[model samples]
Every structure is written in structure tokens, then in C-alpha cells.
Target: MHLIIPNWAGVPANIGALATLRSGGVSQGPYDDGNGGGGLNIGAHVEDAPQAVVLNRALLGVLLPASPLWLTQVHGHHVVDAGEVDNVPGAVEADAAIATRPGVVCAIQTADCLPVLFADVNGRVVGAAHAGWRGLQGGVLQNTVARMRASGAGPIVAWLGAAIGPGKFEVGADVLQAFTDTAQAPEAAVGASAEMTPAARMAQTQACFTPIAQRPSKYLADIYQLARIALGQAGVTQIYGGGLCTVTDINCYSYRRDRVTGRMASLIWLK
Candidate 1:
């Protein structure tokens, strides 16, 4: 399993960018490593052993910036400042996290939802967002962008983590409508009506289905495209790494593919 991380233009060169894949752990059964067997499954709530999860997390910490701020992610639009979590562990509940000060890591865990990392050119501010269709349509992306703006960060580099890319995500008319119904929500597509509509929604959604072709009423939803649209709404034109399909990649966990699968954490921090 190869871990992938993409750095955006707004992020400073000194800052490190990385994302972990399913490898190096003590979990047995389906979560097993290819050759080593019994891979690292870091989520405590999963069927994987709690001690194994702790061990996996410890192994991950070798490269992480201190301990990562893990959120109790509920697919909502809430964005919290992890910089404020100075007290203890497992005390934060947020769908999105931002770290403006250095030495702090803003992390997000997701099996299929897009894990978006944001940072400014000066490395003064960094952020992570767990953007499923609901959170994206709600306002998580815009909320993160607003927070980054407040920190006097410019360019606002964004890296799209591994997610259910367009090819594997199938959605009904409701999801097609999710990004378009901005009046019902906010900063959603947050763009023009001509580009995103009931008519073109299917075409737009079907552009990425590889092995799994587009179905009738539903279309293959591209989390990357949706994220780029959201980032565009956030006035962030320079985005990177929208090319991963977690659902298709067996090495990665995909809630869409397996509802009970463990999650992968995408983390970013200032050096």
C-alpha cells in the first residue's frame, strides 16, 4: 500500500504533506496486509482490536506532527478550530478542523468522503475537511476557506485526499440536486445556474465511471469534481490531487463500498 499526499500552491514548501494507506498493522482477517497479513486498522470503533488500533496509531505517529487532532466526525457542516483543543485527547467533536498555529495538525478521517487539506503560502494556517456530499452541500468547504482567509492566508492551497472518485460513486436525483440546491443550503456549488442544473447534472456526474458504467436515474458522482466545484466557490482556483478513487482501490477503505469499513486519516501541519 502506497500512501499518497499532494501539496498545493498556497502551501509553503517547508510544510509536509502526506496521507496514509492500509498497511503496517496488527489487525487480522479482512483487514490483513497483503504479504505481512493482519494490517494496521487505526479506527477504534471498527471490528479491529482496540489495542491493534492503538498500535497502528503509534506506528503512524512516527511521521505525524505530534498527535493528530482526531474529530468525532458526523457528516455535518460544523467547522471547529483544533487550535483551540489545548486540553485533552478525544474531547473534540467536529466535521472540519483548522490549525492556524504551528506544531498543530488538523486531521480528518474518511473512507469515501473527500479529505481536503488547505494551507496558505506562508504556512501560517492549515486545515482539513471531511466533505461528503452532505457536508459539501452544507458548507464545510466554504467554512474552511473562510477560516483560512481569517488567518491572512492567500492562494489557499488545497489538496484533495483519496475519496470515492467520480467513477465509483453512484447517486440519485437527490444527490445530483444536492450541490445545485444552494438556496436550500449555502455556498453549495455556490456558482452559476447554467453550469450546474437538473439537465446537465447527469452528464457531469457520469464523466468519471470507469469499470462501473453510469446507470439510469443515478450517475457516478465524482467527489473530486464536487470538491473542485466547492473550492471554486471558495475562490480557490489552484487545487491539486483530485485523481483517487477509494471505492475502487481495495487497499483503501470506502464506506460506500463497505458500510462498516475503517477510515483513513488525512493530515497536514506547518513545519
Candidate 2:
């Protein structure tokens, strides 16, 4: 099983974090690894055989302290406590989860969408957020950071997992407008000094979308840059682990590249 361990120096020794690649599991067909091996598609909602997903998750579970708290991602900004998720009936519909207790894994599944993992530098808490374009524009990462801070976390650091790269992620004017049109400061702007003025923030956001001359009303949006701006606005400055492009990297899954593709998981927890 190949896993991308986050190379983040800000993470405390007690915290554990890893992003799963498409390789290593029992899934087949569209969920199969791009190189013809079984894939590690842990997403239960992706229409893969239920039994295969079970086995794949079981394989992943062997490396974790406990089973991951998987949420039904809605591409929204809702954040939840990972420890409280299991007590709820049915599947939780949050796009991000924070874990204050040890061994409580906060997991986010994605193919093209960004999976961001967060942790307190002091190892007090950990979190995972699924940030598709919608969720990113909707404030998912800020909400996760706010929840972690509310739970007593200190100086949080984040690691950006694999996602569609700027070169391959094409977006329309509406997608660009969704970010540029909003000037609200991040919900978790920790200090007044760290806050970017509404105009500055909008300018930073506009820079993330580059117009594609060949395609009218189209642009190449850099999800990583957008994430960095958002995290910076939220007062999280020590960020790491970006530039892995799912669409171009065969080891990772890419829904945009393959319409019927498997999903990879990015997970974090306190040991």
C-alpha cells in the first residue's frame, strides 16, 4: 500500500497524517488503480461494489489507530467534530471534521477536489477538509480551523493534499466570480493584523484564476493558491504539501481525467 505521508515540519510528533494514493486495495474496474492493480478506493458513495469498498477500507484501517470518521460530503462549508459524528444517526453530512481526541481519525475523500489536513503544532487537535471549488469558495477550511481553535487547538498548520492542478482545472466565469465577488474575511481570522482587507483579499483571489486565451470565458484556476490565500486569511501560515496534481499523476485518482474514477482519502489524527 502506497501512502503519501505529509512532509510537514509543523506537525507535532504525536500527530499522524497520510494521504492515500489510488494504489493498494481490492477495488476493480473504474475504481482500479490506474496501472491495472486494485485501487484503494475507500469512498462508499462512489458506486463501487460495497464489498470491495469494505475490504479497501479494512486495508486502510490496518494502519490507523481506529476506523476513520467518514462524512457524506456535500461540497459545503459545514464542519463537525469527529468524535461526535458516530453518535449521530445515519451518515453525517459535513464537508470537514475535527478531532480533539487521540485515535479519532478525521478523513476526507477526494478525486479531483482538494483534501486538506490540519493539526495543532502542539498536537492538541487534528482535522481534515474536502475542498472542492464550491467548498473552498464556501469557507470549509476556515470553518475547520475555527472549530479546532474552539476545541483548544494552538497554532494550527495545514497540509494540502493532491488535487486537480491549475494547468488542468478549467473553470468558467461563474466559478471565478464565486470567489472574486465575495469580500468577506475568513470566519477564523485569528488576529486583526493577519486579516487582509476586503480589496486585498479579492485581488489575491483574482490572481488565482488565469484567463485561458484559447478558450473564451474560461480560466485555469489554481486550487492550491486559492487554498493558501484562504488559509493565510484564517491565520494559518505554516502550510505544506501541495503541487501533486491528480489529473497528471497516475498514482492518484482524478475524476476529471476519468469520469468513473475511484476516490483517494486524506486522513489525520492525534496519536
Candidate 3:
């Protein structure tokens, strides 16, 4: 199976992290691997053959330290403790998970949504967040950082996983407004400028969302840049891995490119 081993620095030696590509399993049809071979479809919720998904997960199991705590992501800001998860994969309703204990793998599945993996410099905690636009707007990344801090973590670093790129992630005016509004409070809290009014702050947020010249009221939102602003507000300055784009990368899956596609996974754990 193809995998992306995060090329980050300062993470403790015991922390292991990787993001999977869509290949090297038994899923067929819409979930087929890049070369039409058996694909690794980890999401049982995506309507692939149940047994095929089961087999794919079994294959994934060989690589993990333990069963990854997979959540039923609602694109909300709910963050769960992976160390506390004991039910089935989809039973927990959350978009992010953190685990301070060893052997508990925090995992996030995504087709086009951004998957972010977090690790403290001291290696006391690790987390994974599924940051789709809705979840991002609702504060999922900030919540994950807060939970890690509450768990006794120190300075945190993040690895941005594959997602829809700005070129393909076109959004309407409402979506633009959501992020603009969400960006304001954080900027203000960081002592942006007392002289800056709400309108100026909103204008500052526009840098992350570029209007498409051909499409009125439509924009290309940079999920990576938006994530950086959120994480920066949360005090996570050491960030990496925001270069890949699922929509254009065949090795990854993109729901926007293929409505009925398999899901990829990003997982992190402390050994």
C-alpha cells in the first residue's frame, strides 16, 4: 500500500504517523486502486461492499499499533479522546480525536476533506482532525489543540494531509462569509489592531479566499492557509505538509472528482 510518512521535525522518536493512499487492498468498482487493482477502502460508511471494506481494514490493521479510533465525522467541531473510545468505529460522533496514551491511534478518514495530525514536541499527546470547511469554521482544530493542552501537552506541531486544493474547492458567498467571520475573533484576540474595525478584520480574512473572475460570488478557498490561520490562533506554529492536493492527485481519492470514491486515512500514534 502507498503511504505518506510525514516528513516533520521535532516530533519525539516514539510517535508514528502516516497517511494512506487509495491502493493495495480488495475494494472494487468505484473504490478500485489507482491502477484498477484492489483498493484500500477504509470507510465502511462509503457504500463499498462490506466484506471488501472489512478486508481493507484488516490490511490496514497490519500497519497500526492498535485499532485506530475512527469516528463518525459530522463536519462539526466535536473532539473526542481516542483513549476513551471503546465502541464501534462509527459510534462516536466527532470530527477530531486526541490520545495521550500509548498504543491509542488517532485516525481521520477523508476523501476531499483536510486531515490534520498533531503532536506535541514532548510527545505526551497526539491528535488527528478531519477539517472539512464546516468543521474548520466551527473550531475543530482549535478544540483539538485545547484538548491536547488540557492533557498536559506542551508546544504542538501539525502535519497537514491531503485535501481538495484551492484551485478545485470553489465556494459560494455563504461559505466565504463563514470563514471570514470565524477568522475575525482570533485575529482580534491576537492583538491584531485596536484601530481595525470589524470590516477591516473581515477584509484581512479575504486573503485566504480568492474570488473567481469568471464566476460571480464564487471563490477558491485555500484549505491549507485557512488551517494555518486557525492553528496559529491556537498557538501551533510548527506546521508542515500542506502541498498535496487530492483532487488532482490520482494516488489519493477525491469525492468531488468521483462522487462514489473510496476514502483515504491519516493516522497518528505514540509507541
Candidate 4:
């Protein structure tokens, strides 16, 4: 199956990370690759054929050390320990997962939503978070970094995976207000503005949302910039991989582009 090995520098040799593309599997119909071939749809809860998902996951399993710990993402800020839910029978409800031990893969499935992979400089711990707009606004990345630090990680770095690009991600006034309100909140300025004044930080956050002239209260929201602001708030500055756009990149799946579609997975683990 096609995969994207993160090009992050200073990543320890023992940390394994990859983002899957939508190709090289047995799924058909809407789940098939955009080129009319089989797709590597890894999400089992997207109404894809059960047997097809099984076959596709098996195809992906050949490249990994063990089965991935999948979560029932709710676009919330809950973070879970991968080792605790790796082999569990039922679905674990969380937006992010962290793994401290080797062979326990932390995975996040996404279509148009952003998938972020995390690793410390020393590879002591790794994490994966599914950050849609809701999750981003809810502080998922900050929570993930916090949990990683608590689990003995140091100086974390993050890599953004495929998602809808800012040019194509249209949003309403509520979306703009949500971020603005958060940026102006007293607690939000504490760590995020440590390097700058609260006014400057607010400007940085507001700059991510550009007004759409044709649409009265709509704006083009840059998910990547929003994520950077969130990470900055958590004291993580070394970040990478934010240019890929699932909506326009045929190699990846986009739920917004196609209402009914499969999902791609971003995974990270210690070797």
C-alpha cells in the first residue's frame, strides 16, 4: 500500500511514523481510490463493506509492527493511552492517543479532518490526534502534548497530515467567533502568548481567518495555522507537514469533496 513516511528531522531512528494514501486495497465503489482502483480505506466505521475493510486493514498490517489502536473519534478533547486500548475488544472513545512502549501503534483516521502525529526528540513517547475544526477549537493538540509530557516525554514535535486546505475550508461566523473568543480568554493567553503580548497573539490567531467577500459572514479558515497556535500555547514550536490538502490531492480521501467516502489513517509508534 502507498504510505507517507514523515520527513521530520531529528526524529529518533526507533520512532516509526507513516500516513496512508487512498490506494492499494480491496475496497470498491465510493471507498475505491479516486483512480478507479482499490483504496486502502482503514476506517471500519465508515459504512464500508465489512470484508473489504478487513482485507484492506490486512494489507496495511503487513507494514506495521502490530494492529493499530483505533478510536471512536467524537471531535472532542479526550486523550487515551494506546497501551491500555491496543488489544481491547470494543471501540475506545477519544480524539487522541499516546504510546510510551514500542509496538503499540497510535492511529487516527481522517477523511477531510486533520491528522497530527507527535514524537519527542528522544522518541520516548509518540502520539496521534484527529483534529477536525471542533477538536482544534476544543484544545485537542494542547491536551495531547500535555498528556505526552505527563507520560515522560520531552520537547515534543508534531507533523501535520492530510486535511482540507484553507483555500477550500469555508466557515461561518460562529467558527470565527469561537476562535476569537478562545484567543481573548485569559487562560488561552497564558502559555500561547509567552513569546509575545496578548494583543499580538490575538492578532496572530485572527489572521488565520480571512473574510470571504462574496459570503457575508463566511471566512476561509486555515486549519494548519490554527493548529500551530494551539501547539504554541502548549509550548511546542518545532512542527512540520502542513501543505498536503486532501480535498484537492487525489491520492488522499476527502469526505467534504465526496459526501460518502473512505478514510485514511495517520499512525505513530516506538520501534
Candidate 5:
């Protein structure tokens, strides 16, 4: 299947990373191009044909050192060690995966939700996170970093994969408050205000959530920016790969655009 190589630089040669596109596989109907063509549909839980999912994974396997640790994501903040799940395939229930052992690929499936890949400067460890709004607000990114650090990873570099862009990801007031209520005001802002109130802290968190014109209580949230904010909070400064939008780009799958669309995968592993 066609894979998009990550555009990150300075990462060690041992680290191999790429995100899959919705092309080059054997599937049909909603799982394929709907006209009997090669469509790489890898999500087994999305009601795709079991044999098709297996064949898609087999196609993906031909390019990797070993099988990837596929996660059954529930939009929750659960990060699992990839080394511990070498034989389980897609049986693990987690939103993120981290790997230090060689050839243990950490993989995350996404249609519109942001798939974030992480690697240390020295290539000692790598991780993949599924950052939907709920998981992002609940600290999935933070938890991934924490797991990597606890396993001896150094300063982390992150690569954001294709996701629904801010213009297409509309949300209600509750989604906005979910981020603002938990977000703390920047130290500089707090100092400037002398005593920042809850309202002020909430305001400071508005940079990533923009209100749509004439749409009251509705907002367009920038998941990419929110991911950067979360990664920065975990001391990860080197972040890349966030311009691609799944919703607008036909090359990638987007659940928002088509509810029956296939899922793409973002993966990272050390050689």
C-alpha cells in the first residue's frame, strides 16, 4: 500500500516512520474505492470484511521489520508498551503505543482524529498517539511522553499526522470548555494579570478554538495546535507534520467527510 514517509529531519537512521494513505490494497465496497479497486482499508473494527482487513495488513507487513502493535482506540488516554504486545495484533485496547525494543512498531489508526508520532533525538524510543478531542483534552499526549520518559527516552520530537483541519472540525460549547477548563494560563499571562481568574485562564486557551461566524456556541478547533500545546507542556519542542488535512484532502480517509470511510495508520519503530 502507498505510505507517506514522515517529513521529520535529524532523527536517527534507526527510527522508521510513515503514515498510510487510502490507496493500494485489495478491498471492495465501502472498504475499497466502491468500484472494485485497491483501497488499503486496515481497520478491522470498522465493519470492513475480515479477509480484506487481513490482506491489507499483510500488504503493510511486507514493508516493515515486524508486525505493528495495532491499538483498538476508544479515544481514551491509554498508552501501552509495544514490546509487550508483539503477538496480540489488534487486540490491545489503547489510544497510544510506545516502543523501545527494536522492530516493535507502535501504530495508531485514525480517520479524522489526529495521529501523533514521537521519537527521541537518539532514537532510543518511539511512540504513537491517537489524539481525538476527548483524548487530547484528557492528556493522551502527556501520557505518551511520560511513558517514553519512564522507559529511558530523551528529549522527544513529535510528528503530527493527517487529521481533520480546523476549518472542517466544528464542535459545540462543551468541546471548547473541555479544553479551556483544564488549561492553565501561561505563567507570563498570570504574572501580567497579577491574579488571573478562571475566566482569564479560559480566555487564554481560546487561541486554538475559533468561533464560526453567526454560529453561536459553535467553534472550529485546531487539533494540530492543541497537540502542539500538549506536547510543549510535556517539554517536547521539536514538532512537525501538521499541514495535511484528512477532511479536505481526498488522499487520506476522513470520517467527518464520509462516515463509512477507511482508516489510515501512523506508525514508528526503531531498527
Candidate 6:
């Protein structure tokens, strides 16, 4: 299979977009070799062959306008400015988000963690973020949008890429409590606030406005909902994508389903 993510209908006039699928690359067994089995392990740390990672990236390179800003994702909230980025993934430490001048491609790698691409309708700037529950609650999207705005971008449009869907993402009370403060957040997408202890609510206000959804005592959060609330707070409304589920779709990768799984990349740039 070709690593194609049609999450977004088209790359907006000023913006360009493409996210990688798990199939159609190098590696073997659980990682698939082009011989029609499991394949395309892009994560360098996945115990796959280093040579294979290089080769897979090389194949991807042929399609990108520039090298992707691969990050060491630890499920935290840190958005780095691409211009100030150390020209390498290591120098820039952030779990979710990369912004670039024009040709700079902001890239995010994920297996199940959501990869979100942001671009102004005019395409003056482009950015990408990794929005795992922690990062989403931690405000990675808002942080990234802030930087992009500094560059005179945003109130932007966003593309929410694939990740584990809610039906599969079960959680505990802590996760549900994470969003109490989001009431103060510019907005919340239904079920955002339930009944938590006053202390829990205070903690939410102090920490970051982390929105983790819940069902009854525990909300079965739709990560997409969290992203919407968070981005909406940052004045980002024209969001797109958020349809595919990595855990269910074999074509995409999923960390929750299989911890040692391949990774996919979401990229955005200005044309």
C-alpha cells in the first residue's frame, strides 16, 4: 500500500498536507517487508533494523518538500518554533508541534497518538502537533498555535489526523478529571465537565486546561473532542480531519493496540 492519508480533502491553496500510512515500506515480520506482509516500521527505536528505517525515510524523502521534523515524543506538551528549531530533531525537544517559515515542513510521528496539522487559510505558516491524552490536556495545540500566531498566522484551520478512537480508549477518573479547568478554557465539547470534587476542579485550573472526556464516573473521551475544545480556545475553528481511527485501521499504526508498533508521520508545508 502507498503511505497516503487523505484525512484532509485537499491541501489548501497556501498549504500542503500528507500523512503516512503504516504499509508499503521496509522491515520484516511484525514490520512487514514489501513481500505482502506486515511492513513499514518507521520508528528508529522500535527494535527494527536501523538500515531499514533509513531506507523507509529515504522513500518518504522522495515525496516531501524538505526533511520532516521528527520528534522524540514523550506524551507531553511542548511546541517548538521551527525557525528557532536546532535544524535537527534532537535539538528541538517537544512532544507535539513544529512551525516553519515557508518551505519548512512541520512533521509529527505517531502510532496512535493523534497527529494534527495546522495552517492558515493563506498559508503564511504551517505546523504539526502530537496530541496524545497528556499532550492534549497539557495544551500542546494551544501552545503551537500561539507560536504560529507570533509569525502572523492563525485563528487558523487545522487537520486532525488518525489516532486511537474513543471506543478503544478506556480511561480512569484522573483522565476524566483532567478537563475540569477547561470550563475556564474558551470552550468544552459536551461532557467536558461533569461532577468532580472541588479540589479536583482547583487542580485543573492551576495546572493546564487539560480536557479529557468521561462517560459516567469516567468519561469515554473522544480525543477529537478534546482537540476541538483546546484548539477552539486558541481561536482555531476551521478544523478538518479527525475521522480515521488508528487502532481499528490496519493501514495506520496503533500504540495502544500494540505498544511495539510502527509509526506514521503527519506533515504540512506551504506550497
Instruction: Kindly report which residue pairs in candidate 4 clash with one another.
Output: none
**lDDT tens readout by residue for model 3, 1-271:** 8999998989999899999999889999789986879899999888999999989888998998888987999999999898886857788999999998899998999999999999999989999999999998888998999999999999998999999998999899999888777656644454223466766667766887889998899999999988887787687889999979899998898999999999999999999
Where does candidate 5 have its weakest 10-residue lDDT segment?
Answer: 185-194
Model 2, position 28: C-alpha lDDT score: 94
> What's the lDDT for residue 42 in model 1?
66
TM-score of 4: 0.97
Ranking by TM-score: 4, 3, 2, 5, 1, 6
TM-score for predicted model 2 compared with the true structure: 0.94
Which parts of model 2 are misplaced by more than 4 Å? 87-90, 184-197
Off by over 4 Å in 1: 34-36, 86-89, 183-216
Q: Encode model 5's per-residue lDDT on 39-76: one tens digit a residue.
A: 79889888988898899999998888998887778999
What would the per-residue lDDT of candidate 6 be over residues 1-271, giving only the tens digit for each residue?
4655544433467577788887778777566633456466778878788888888888888877778777777788877766566667545678755555666777788887888888776567778888988898887888888888888874577888888887777666677666665444433332333444455544544343233454445445578877876776677767788868888887777778767677778878776
TM-score for each of the candidates: 0.85, 0.94, 0.95, 0.97, 0.92, 0.82
Candidate 2, pairs of clashing residues: none
Q: Highest TM-score among the candidates is held by which one?
A: 4
What is the C-alpha RMSD, rounded to one decimal, of candidate 6? 5.5
Which 10-residue window in model 3 sums to the lowest lDDT? 186-195
> TM-score: which is higher, 1 or 4?
4
- In model 6, state the lDDT of residue 114: 85
Q: Write the per-residue lDDT of candidate 1 for residues 25-54, one digit (tens) a residue.
A: 677755655344656666766677778788
lDDT of 6 at 168: 73
Q: What are the C-alpha RMSDs, in order, of all predicted structures?
A: 3.5, 2.0, 1.9, 1.2, 3.1, 5.5
For model 4, the stretches where C-alpha displacement exceeds 4 angstroms are none
